[model samples]
Target: MNTFAHIKPIAQYNKVSYYSVCIEGNEISLFEEFITHHTSTNKKKLNHVLDWIKLIGNKYGAQSHLFRPEGETADASALPPKGIERKPHYTEYGKKKANNIRLYCLRANENVVFLFNGDIKTAHYAQDCPNVRKHFKLANKLTKAIDSAFANKDIVWNDDCTEIDCEDDFKLQF
Candidate 1:
């Protein structure tokens, strides 16, 4: 069976255009599902991750240093990077912390990011973690499909490489 996902625009910030995927037949986008699932159980961590996303989208852009590489392939990454700490009186500061919550995504460029779904990773490796195994695999598959779309000119970067241009009904199959 083939799985399909459509690129759904989430937010357009000054530095980047944030996006998420809506899989065929699903009511909510993957990123929305991720937020809903973790909202109650991991509120604080979720906030931290959101803060990071806001900072990237509004101020910093999707810089390479912000994402934690996730997949074996080069495309997938996660948010709320390791070693980041939440200080009481300062902006997001740095300190070692084991963040189990993973939100897999693709940092398309400094100006575009595609948010995917993820879960609490219980193991060191995504494939070994029961909770995040499917998410990780799905992220990788979607990443590859999106990459191919770009390669085939189905998805083209806008001028300045800050955004992408594609048909409104463009869908990726994996």
Candidate 2:
């Protein structure tokens, strides 16, 4: 009861972040930052991206719990240990196509998170550097949104346990 009361707002906020990301590389540090909250905000576009993040993160509880990145793309953090499926999707970049690109989710703490891509088709063209950034950024938002929603509901987010899965993770499992 206490947990759901605490996290209800987080879910509302995360629902927004999930929609905030449309362009590539705009939302990466979001999901990861929620848990570690250590992203550096080093990118020139930090203001808009960070604003979106904080607005959503605040719904959970506090921002300090999240892992802040020194730079948006400084390093690639593997998805959280809570097992979820990675569904391969395609994106196109210039002349390159990133194939079987996984559009998937991660359970970061209590967050109900996942990634998105523009590669609805012709994935081979999705290999451009821009595509990578876009993917990472969108992935960030999905992650943050997930984090915000699940706030104190980690068990619910993970079906590998008895708690019934919530929102989208139950469907995302591959």
Candidate 3:
């Protein structure tokens, strides 16, 4: 079955531009849905992931070292790798120990990234985790489709390669 989706920019910073996928007929993007779903059950992990996203977008510039490869067939990755610990100084929340939340994405380049959906990984591997299995599969599929789009010139890079240039109505099928 063919699934249709579109890319929309959710956030833009001086260093990187973050885009998210919105499936056909869906009001919220996959990334947004991930945030909403985890807000109640995984607030700390969610905040940690969000903080990294902001840092990557505003300061770090989507560095490859910040993401963990998750794609089986494409160049997709997941954020907040396992065993990463950070102390959240912004809130009264204590140190961020081990975060199981995995937000899959495509690190298009130093300046571009595509944020996708994810869930709390209950098992050691995403394939073995019931919570993240579907999301992992969907993210890989979309990543492959987006990769093809780039190869076919459907998605082009800006002159400086700091951003992507695509039609507003451009739709991707996966």
Candidate 4:
């Protein structure tokens, strides 16, 4: 399986720290790449996303709507853009928008979230859209890889769950 080579600290606030997923040989993270691409191509939408992140970090900490389940039910019927089912291992974080954007993250713990990837919602149902489906598939793959890394001790969290320490050679196997 592919493992992540590094867990780069991306942001920290209110004693909560956020991280980016980096694979071996990649200087920039998947999250950074997403930001860069969206910033240049879709500045307005990207601004909304960044603002949402800032609000989550500065105001809510771990209790923000961004980190919460998209729906109250397992099938996420509470929200229409349903793609992946909400589980403890992985969940979708998104800000409601006319042009919806969703970020997938792995729940490392109560206090830590690792951003894997995201997508732009163009339809009422995510499964009906090709890009949304592709994004969810990627999220699922990353979720498995992360779970394996956790099982193997490649990813370890500090005592207070304030930091994550990963293996230097860790890279996503998929």
- Top-scoring candidate (lDDT): 3
Overall local distance difference test of candidate 1: 0.84
Per-candidate RMSD vs. true structure?
3.2, 15.7, 2.4, 7.2
Q: What C-alpha lDDT values do all the predictions have?
A: 0.84, 0.32, 0.85, 0.57
Using TM-score as the measure, name the better of candidate 1 and candidate 4. 1
Poorest 10 consecutive residues by lDDT, candidate 1: 84-93
Which tens-of-lDDT digit does each residue in 59-160 have in candidate 1?
A: 889988888987565468998776635322123235446667889999988999999988888898888899988998888888899999999998999889
User: What is the Cα-based TM-score of model 2?
Assistant: 0.27
Query: Local error of candidate 1 at 124, Å?
Result: 0.9
Pairs that collide, model 1: none
Better of 2 and 3 by TM-score: 3
lDDT of 2 by residue, 20-120 (tens): 22223233333333323223322322232334344534454222223223134432122211112211112234332223222223334333333233221
Per-candidate TM-score against the hidden true structure: 0.89, 0.27, 0.90, 0.70
Model 4 CA deviation exceeding 4 Å by range: 1-6, 68-99
Tens-digit lDDT track of model 4 for 117-163: 56666665556656556655565666676677778887877888767
Worst 10 residues of 2 by lDDT: 1-10
